[model samples]
Target: EGMDVVSFASSAGPNNQQVITEQQLSTLFSNVEEILEANQKFLLSLRQLGFEWTNNPQHLGEAIKKHIPPLKKSYMTYATNFYHAQVFLLSLLEETKPGPLMSYITRWEKEVIKIDMSPLLSYLILP
Candidate 1:
């Protein structure tokens, strides 16, 4: 459990680039569930972090760094695991074909198809 958890997160993201992690680490430190649940420790951790997203949370990284230091080590492991779990859940739903979450995911897919990506083409498109 004490296995340099952030390193794992650093290794598992897109391009194995730890896209979930950053130099300042504002996002991952903000959620205990994101740190623990992703590491397969869901039952041992709190289900929520008791914080809410506001338009501006004010020095949020400072607050998170102060408060969440105890749980910040393993965010990537948690995120990777959580992503796998969601994929598994979605596939399970797909095989059975139809449920509340499945319906929501389907709706999201429909909405995504309507997005206009042309604006980002210059910066995001690969040569």
Candidate 2:
């Protein structure tokens, strides 16, 4: 899918010049989707735990410990890649006008780039 909005800048053919290639965008979106999927899986497991462990408060720590490793791995992946992605997007925005890539950048910001994972990282760092 693609997004569109009004553009005050002049139109240029796809081949005229490229700020980012199609392949780069695809890879970026794929990474974001993978991270989202991992987080969703982690949340689902926690929900399931809430039901199954409702009567086992003492053993909650043991159950929760198993989920943390994978969640940490997923977040570590994000922390590793996020800066490069941010720099890439910011540079692209600086180079191009607000028309062609605007919708895609907006989607990236809303879906993935806007995430603030610092507080979440504290959990991993502390325990």
Candidate 3:
């Protein structure tokens, strides 16, 4: 519960400054981790299917049996939720950058957080 993932933890700002609430930051990662787990499971199921690009009925049928509807649902779920989270985090980073709170954020944080914005990239690398 004392993890240092909070963006404000490393800041050089005044100890009394209030930039982002702990609940806001925690909730963002909580939602992200939740969607990440759900989407990883779905993506892994596709990877595990191991069907080639053949036109055979059996192979195609196996793919179809894997349920495309739910896959699409999961994809959309991840896409929309992640988009909102990314927008919020990006705005937060920018809003804090010119202020004393910016000192609390490291350059690594700015660079690495950009990677968190893409959900599709996760599908490609998760397996």
| TM-scores vs. true structure, each candidate | 0.31, 0.52, 0.39
lDDT of 2 at 4: 21
Ranking by lDDT: 2, 3, 1
List ranges where model 2 is wrong by over 4 Å.
1-23, 26-30, 51-54, 97-99, 103-127
User: What lDDT would candidate 1 get against the real structure?
Assistant: 0.40
- Show model 1 residue runs off by greater than 4 Å: 1-77, 116-127
Runs in model 3 with CA error above 4 Å?
Answer: 1-56, 95-127
What local distance difference test score does each model get?
0.40, 0.51, 0.50
- Ten consecutive residues with minimal summed lDDT in candidate 2? 1-10
Tens digit per residue, CA lDDT, model 1, 59-112? 454455544554445544445444444444445345665643345445544555
As for candidate 3, its clashing pairs are 11-104, 12-104
TM-score of 2: 0.52
In order, what is each prediction's RMSD in angstroms? 15.9, 8.9, 7.9
Highest lDDT against the true fold, candidate: 2
Task: Give the alpha carbon lDDT tens digit for every residue of 1-127 in model 3.
Answer: 2234444543334766665565655433434444445556656766765655354457556655666665565555555556555555556656733554344444545555687754322322221
Per-residue CA lDDT of model 2 for 32-57, tens digit only, reads 44555666776776776776676776
